[model samples]
Target: MARVELYVSADVEADGPIPGPYSMLSFGLAVCGTFDGTRFTAPDPSERTFYAELKPISGDFDPQALEVSGLDRERLLREGRDPAEAMRAAAAWVKTVADGALPVLVAYPLAYDWMWLYWYWVRFTSRSPFGHSRHLDIKTFYAARAGAMAARSTKRQMPAALLSARPHTHNALDDAVEQAELFQNLFRWGG
Candidate 1:
């Protein structure tokens, strides 16, 4: 028998363009809901969530990227959680929340966040909770569902009804929760 697909919205704040040379300053995950093939059940996104800030793996960083997250690299070097411990904890959290269901990562655009998280997971934990390919790009989801060009399916272009009320605070956890609501709205949309 097929199990439910638990959608987890992910958001990452980084200090540079990519991982390794830079660092994923922080990241967050929020449980959006579940889909048992036919029905989508929306959940309270704030209830099941994970957040972590990690020490920089490399000293190199982009000033503009740092500006976006507003996380101090110097402070993080001193106070951030160890990457291995954090990623392992995050993986465990995903498993616990997923229970018997399959966890499918849901992210806006998908590529950027996935790149950082997947790299960190493999680097630090040897694997990822969402596996290698079970993920969804909300932008593409909207583009297909709305019958619009892929490039034209940006959040600014989405129906106002589909947008979440929460502000995009750039904090990974806040953005993750906000993204969860947007995912719920997009999943239940008919067209």
Candidate 2:
């Protein structure tokens, strides 16, 4: 029996910096690759994915953050899905795509995305599919694998081969897919 891990690239668009004080307006997940202890298989970014927009939990939000995402707070207030239902659906989707493999969340800088995701998972679904700590930070992973200083791990500093071809549009799903490509590239990169 070999250990299996599903690399899920997740991106979140939020109203503010923190979860409790603000809210995660939308999120997207794309299964980038899978590793079965020995080898990795990269998937098409559009293959298996999930996206959701949730109603705000709090009235307070940073105007600048909202601007970054280009999501209308007023529209979300009127049309967003319930957080609990959205989280449950997302968790179920993760499980379905993972198909018994351990699902590991992957993000550019896990700090910000993971914060909103983990908090929302617990607050809405009562548990996280990634089990609280199983996450990959792309920037950090690249820094460690490439022997670059942590502070200098920006995409511009990385090799051209490891960067995604897609643009970093603020749309959660688009960014998730873009990051999925990035994750595949980084996973295939050798020391």
Number of the predicted model whose lDDT against the real structure is largest: 1
CA deviation > 4 Å runs, candidate 1: none
Pick out the ten consecutive residues of candidate 2 with the lowest summed lDDT. Answer: 182-191
My TM-score estimates for the predictions, one after another, are 0.99, 0.98
What is the per-residue lDDT of model 1 for residues 20-127, given as tens digits with 9 covering 90 to 100? Answer: 999999999999999999889998999999999999999899999989999999999999999999999999999999998999999997999999999999999999
Q: Candidate 2 lDDT, tens digit per residue, 44-110?
A: 9878999999999999999999889999989999999999999999999999998989999999988
CA lDDT for candidate 2: 0.93
Model 1, residue 131: what's the lDDT?
Answer: 95
Rate residue 187 of model 1 by lDDT.
Answer: 87
What C-alpha lDDT do the candidate models reach, one value each?
0.95, 0.93
Q: Relative to the unseen true structure, what is the C-alpha lDDT of residue 191 in candidate 2, on a scale of 0 to 100?
A: 45
